[model samples]
Target: MTKDTMSIDTSAELLENDILPMIREVHTDPDVPCASQGDMPKALAEPVAKKSPAQWAYERIIMYIQNFEKQLDNDHEVGMGLAGGNTGVIRIEGLGYYDPDIVTYYGTSEAGAKTQLIQHVSQLNVTLIASPKHIDQPEPKRIGFRLAAGLERSEDVTT
Candidate 1:
């Protein structure tokens, strides 16, 4: 099958053989494959980022469509959403995200930045998710081994 049609469900394995060796990060060996999307950090998402808040809000609503598709592919009895992967609405004033089942963000501000996001994850029964992106700083936590361990348990995860 062409790479395009190759199933990503087994991406965990493809990651081990095809993608890991060339990586520069010492901790990024085959055992822990990074983002399924690849080095998204190197690829600028600014054009997509420039979209207005309204646009972001709209696009996010359907981010979980594929996950739903997977659930449909199953017999429909058992679904996974209570552990490390789950999606829910995150409301921050004029912002909203129907986040994918694997993203977690926390902020620390007058609005309870660090605490609020931590509380949200705790309530959801999720213990880990992908790291948030920031244009200004390099978050070592998002790099490799750290990411795998940083948010292992959602209850205590915070910036």
Candidate 2:
């Protein structure tokens, strides 16, 4: 099966434009369903607290980035199921040139992953493992990115 890939900018503008609408739908439409609390163990799923839409969006984005980082660090398959039977694998890292070891550790190479750290804004590439049964949909929630190491260090220094 062929994977359809998309490069997305995870900047505030893009998030507001591409992602927020779908998120609004998920939260407001009772039929659409919020993220499944059922899949989680009872201990984890119980005591679900309500949050504002902005907080929910922020939390969801943070969770996606953190999960992606864990998958990269552990060398696990970094895939998430999207709507309509399509699955996607996400890769994100710091901006700028990285040593070969860093690239290798992150399971991406200069040719593949080192294209940009934070060119216009934070960016990510999503490779969708799609089949004929899968229909494409806007899934901004699936994409994530993190600050580049260099950028983080610089900010730390300035602070």
Candidate 3:
């Protein structure tokens, strides 16, 4: 076989055997049901051939967030604690990744004001928390599944 073809085969083998396993091992939580490699959305899993670091981090984080939400009672929803200051937690309503570097979060602050945090992948530090759902609001919708679905749709359009 040609050198290029052999290298591509080696890369795919490494990703399947080494990288995916390490990700599963590191992110495994005893309390939450983590998504197995097989459970990864086709858009996210199949397109790993070319992705930015921020995109990779975003996809993995989405899986973890989805798993964490599964363990929450209806009375609680997922919130994210930002790093580096008195920046309070935000209810994670939406998440996005911008090409090679940025990860953006959209949600409401503790006081219920709309908020968004745009962060570099290098500085991304996330702490997912289960916060009490607002008294008047119905159970918060799980954003992870929605996000994954969006990825699928976008992939469909691109391909």
Candidate 4:
């Protein structure tokens, strides 16, 4: 078989033999729902041989953020609390990964000023918080979907 065919076969085998089984075994809090098989993006199902650690971390984080957002009410949006130091919370507006080992966040602070944080994959620690939506906004922003869509678009462009 050609190299591309071989790679496709390997990926299908891996998904059936490894990824699907593991996903089935995943457990979560009774009150908090997790991503179902259908909810997972296709990019996540297909394994990439040379994916960087940063890219892997970024994808997993996006999955988590998406799941968490599903548990929020319309009045609340996702915010991230940084660990260590006196760094405060930020409303997560955007996310990006730098190849090799870096993840970056762009958002607004508690005071509503623009903020950005960059961290190495090793030191990455994020606590998702439910912050109240702005008074003028009719509903909380569901960033998880947007972020996941962006990730898929980036994958499409790269491929």
Candidate 5:
């Protein structure tokens, strides 16, 4: 669930490590998957993610940031991927404080409800939802990964 079969190098040359912390819009709710009753736990199956789809997407980005905070090293890399234009890359110099967000596209027209759904890197409250990943072999892609400091957490974790 870490590196891909073919490594894609993303050198950290975007910004200086002397970047300051930005108080981005705080996020709380998590992007919980509506798993089938059999596939999910008692708590997950419940109605937890009451936030609007936009909020859910934002929390997902925050979760990704918190999880990746642990696995990546000081010399780590970053890149850009598209989730229907719902994502933007935010690299903070030397610190791996990546944070992806979800921009809302109110109307679903020919433009195709465009919104940002990024996989950002940052800290988060453990009270949020736990990792929403499948334990199956070859873990799913880290669409919403988090990188909290220390090993008592998941690499692509949320809470």
Candidate 6:
């Protein structure tokens, strides 16, 4: 037989016997090498939650403050208020001249000299600057702070 006729006859024979590679509706395990597109298992993907840069900085600042508070000596006391209705004061006690560990100050006029002494103490100086640069933004909503500890030691002073 001629080559063309011989190839056509062979193809016809293969088709009749169902020996050609035909598509099969097979369900295979993902681990198997012969797994088809539909038979392959889905990937175990997880979604990650993202936080804004400002929010991330805020969280980090909070964590750092918390850790610092935890490491502080138990004998110390902390007091907070605004100075002259403008500057914010974070008072750290136990570093003052008062016999008691804590010292309370009101508006600098009330405890002006004592407050100055407290501010100068190397051990009890807790300065927190809430600059707009901390969050890398020119503007921010009303800033707020929390005192997890301190405001203890009602030990001394007047007014």
Which digits, one per residue and each the tens of the lDDT, describe model 3 over residues 73-124?
A: 8999999998888779999998888888899899999998999999999998
Sliding window of 10 residues with minimal summed lDDT for model 2: 97-106
TM-score of candidate 1 against the unseen true structure: 0.20
Native-referenced Cα lDDT, model 5:
0.30
TM-score, candidate number 3: 0.78
Question: lDDT scores for all predictions?
Answer: 0.30, 0.30, 0.76, 0.79, 0.30, 0.30
Report the lDDT tens digits of candidate 4 across residue range 1-159: 666664445766866654542444356656557665345676676555547778777877888888889889999999999999776999999888888899999999999899999999999999999999899999899988877775566355122
Give candidate 5's error at residue 95 in angstroms: 16
Off by over 4 Å in 5: 1-49, 77-79, 83-159
Better of 2 and 5 by TM-score: 5
Evaluation by TM-score, superior candidate among 4 and 5? 4
Between candidates 2 and 3, the one scoring higher on TM-score is 3
TM-score, prediction 2:
0.22
TM-score list, all predictions: 0.20, 0.22, 0.78, 0.78, 0.26, 0.23
Candidate 3: stretches off by over 4 Å: 1-21, 26-31, 47-49, 153-159
lDDT by residue (70-155, candidate 2, tens digit) is: 33322232332223332233233222222211111122232344322221112223332212211243332223234212122322
Q: Per-prediction count of colliding residue pairs?
A: 5, 2, 0, 0, 26, 0
Q: Could you tell me the TM-score of candidate 5?
A: 0.26
Cα lDDT tens digits for candidate 6, 1-159: 676664345766755444322223333654432212232111101111232333222233333344334333334323344434444553332221332233222222223334433321223433432222213434332212132122111321111
For candidate 1, the 10 contiguous residues with the lowest summed lDDT are 71-80
Model 1 clash pairs are 107-113, 107-114, 108-113, 108-114, 127-154
> How close to the true structure is residue 86 of candidate 3, measured as C-alpha lDDT?
77
lDDT of 4 at 123: 99
